[model samples]
Target: MTDAAPSPDIAVLLADDHDLMRESFRALLDASPGFRTAGEAGTGAEAIRLAREYRPDVVLMDVRMPEMDGIEATRRICADPDLSGVQVLILTTFDLDEYVYAALTAGASGFLVKDSTATELLNGIRLVAAGEALLAPRVTRRLIATFTGKGQPAGSPRGLDEITEREQEVLVLIASGLSNTEIAQELNVALGTVKTHIGRLLNKLDARDRAQLVIAAYDSGLVTPRSR
Candidate 1:
């Protein structure tokens, strides 16, 4: 019997103050197909250095690190004009309302409760790497509600004017939690085309990742999450 060849290599950096958690995530990510643990850090400062030196494709960060904290580190990481392609995924034990919104706005590609299974973890990393926002439909709606103040109109109505019409359409669906494949089918365009549009949208919007895009979509008033 032949074994499946590993997936293409994905460079990963782990940042967590908790040694156990760091080791655990490192093992899970290493076990996943096509993933490599480039480095691990116990604080936000270390995370920043490893991120700059290793330049991993994805960084699994913890929000409560000492010194800089994950949110600040995330902001710095995403702020780097050179490392625009690197994605940061926040992993935390607590899904506190405050932290969730802050992390996403701070340029995290997504936030995952620490209880997530290995499969979910790997999938989240892959999705973020593929330039997709990791927020679930429900989570996205909650974020919109929290930041937009429930129908009070998002930031300047013209904030989204920078995005092209096609890019706007893609942003709307993305904020709605539709995957690229789903968006392609809904828009009747090729999947690769959808990806290209998303990439351009991110650059045009000055968003670091899909999660930030979701925040921008809501903040820019491009799309409103319906109220129940």
Candidate 2:
């Protein structure tokens, strides 16, 4: 006897004004299993409406658009209590520190450049859908440096002193842009063990996401840039 077919995957909403870009993204998402387009919107207002109506598991938001930009739409979507679980991932051409800071502050789970590969885009959607923050380590570092004035780290150095030795070690690696798989290999620990450490670090630092954690790492001097 034949086996039962798998259930359809979580729905996704693609929001962007550009027709060609939207079509391209839709095709890419369609090629991936476990995901289907709930709908598409060309404006921020429409994006917000569809999100509330369809309640997609994830949203692909472009940073720049006419009428209402992606940033405002993200903020509105996240603010709605009913759409709490809907994850927003920003896809744009610029990874400017300003956008990085705003997106993270607005509760975006991930940020990516438009030039990223289809594989990267698919992975980012999955990661955010799984409730993980998707931020490139280098971008995170730059955001932290800018927020803290780069010339000097913020907060009392002692603020992070409370973190255990192991936790600090993990933060350094995280700020350095290593994913769980990479960190596990580098530290000789299991993947599950690395996740546990990261969870602990997030709590100890009172961080909202990995992007914020990277900021804390720099502010606390746990990670520093090389001299000019």
Best by TM-score: 2
After superposing candidate 1 on the true structure, give the runs of residues whose Cα lies further than 4 Å from its correct spot: 1-8, 150-154, 157-159, 162-169, 184-200
Task: Please give, for residues 1-228, the per-residue lDDT of candidate 2 as tens digits.
Answer: 999998769688999998999899888778889878889999988999999999999999887778898888999998789998898988866545576567666767778888888888888888888888898765555555555445566664434767888887788888777788989999899999999999987787777677667667776665776411
Encode model 1's per-residue lDDT on 78-191: one tens digit a residue: 889777878998886544656767778778878777888888889888888776668766556655666554545457433367777888889888887777898999999999
- What TM-score would each prediction reach against the true structure? 0.78, 0.80
Poorest lDDT segment (10 consecutive residues) of candidate 2: 219-228
Candidate 1 — which pairs collide? none
Candidate 2, residue 117: the lDDT equals 88
Q: Which ten residues in a row are the worst by lDDT in model 1? A: 150-159
